[model samples]
Target: MSNSSLLKTAVLAGSLLFGTAGATVGEEADARKILGSMTEYVSSLDALSFDFEEYHEIVTTDGERLGLAASGSVALVRPDKIRVLRRTGYTDTDLAFDGQTLSLTDSDAGLFARHALPGTLDHLIDTLRDDFAKPLPAADLLTGGGHGGLTAPTAEIKDLGVGVVSGMLCDHLALRGEEADWQIWVAQGDTPYPCMFIITSRNIPLAPQYRIEVHKWQAGPVEADFAPEKPAAATEVALADYLKGARNLPPNFIVEVEK
Candidate 1:
């Protein structure tokens, strides 16, 4: 069987094994409602900042699944400005999008790239994904209308009840998509921030997963600069060249868009 066909079969097996069949209609409705509330609350924020830990699993040629881990912080202002800093054992990278330009810097490699893309945060996210093939992890939660974006491809929703993340009580939900399955934990109460997100790829052997856990979340006025500062010794390069160089970097530094 082809990989895609095998993936379909594996998805079916996963649905059965994960109890997706047992989710009741009411439970599904509740799960969707919770997700909507969380998205709405996040959209209403004028500015937000958070610290996160991320894990991405890769399946080797021999079918051994190994994980790569990174820690990062995100700071955003509504509509236009955002900054993300990520650090792994081998790389320290920074991405900043102001109103008129987007910049990416590899601090460890002494290289940087810049592109003029004038738009909102949502547009920047789309450009990064569609044009550059760099999709930020848990990006659905960062868009202006995240509810619609996330729910558009959802085939099923399951309320898995409550969980505690970073000492905060949260509502756990599972959602099945056309090609993959994902889960989220949203903090309970009015804030309703996302505490954790996990996506598993059925198309890959051993079902590699990507996970993000939010350690700190803050929403309000952020007093900081959004301008991208090029490192003094860093050489500027075309965006494509930057991406090419990324492939030579440590594991998980290269972008891998889902098929």
Candidate 2:
């Protein structure tokens, strides 16, 4: 696939999560409890790992199905480190995150690109569970109006009924933002971690979905790798020259492009 397609995948995968409506008096009480517990569960997460197998299919507005594609063993360690390494029908690609940088290296295309992480490790955990597409609602749920970042739905007021998600029972809720709408389901009990999330755009013809599962967790003071030997100099002559002449990079940050 082209790099733009991959970038769309990445940008789409990590959207914001939030409640657009303010809750009512009695209902707000219950919603607050559920939302609070859910927050605690996520806030308490640290040093965990997840391994997931993903299936991706992109059908453009024109009704072209790129066809069903799948991958195995998508792994991650908290604090912005991820590795999508597996054999599959799709492109052979390597995506990694050290604590500070995100890199995508397409071996088949001999291309690589990197960008800086805007915040601390906790932010990454919030991003991971959002979805394969990272729907914006997921991001808002975490940022919550601090430091001029995105805000999440208070979902505390919606009279969302119960539903079965991926064989697990959960409370279903609906929320809308200025730019999007969300349908999310979470575990019914205390600390309701998101079982599934879906997002739809109001102004654009884009509807993307993300399903997240906590496949596994590993404990430690370990970090993910960011540097895997710079791209081959000969292969990246133009890119290297471009970087050498680049400007305006944030302090303590790195920029990488692979092609």
Top TM-score hit? 1
Q: Summarize candidate 2's per-residue lDDT along 138-208 as a digit string, tens digits.
A: 23333222211212543234536688866778876665666666555667765466555555554554444
Can you give the TM-score per candidate against the true fold?
0.86, 0.53
Full-model lDDT, candidate 1: 0.82
Among these predicted structures, which one has the highest lDDT? 1
Model 2 deviation from the true structure expressed as Cα RMSD, one decimal place? 12.7
The C-alpha stretches of model 1 lying farther than 4 A from their native spots are 1-21, 144-149, 247-259
Q: In model 2, which regions exceed 4 Å deviation?
A: 1-25, 51-88, 113-119, 122-159, 189-191, 206-259
Clashing pairs in 1: none
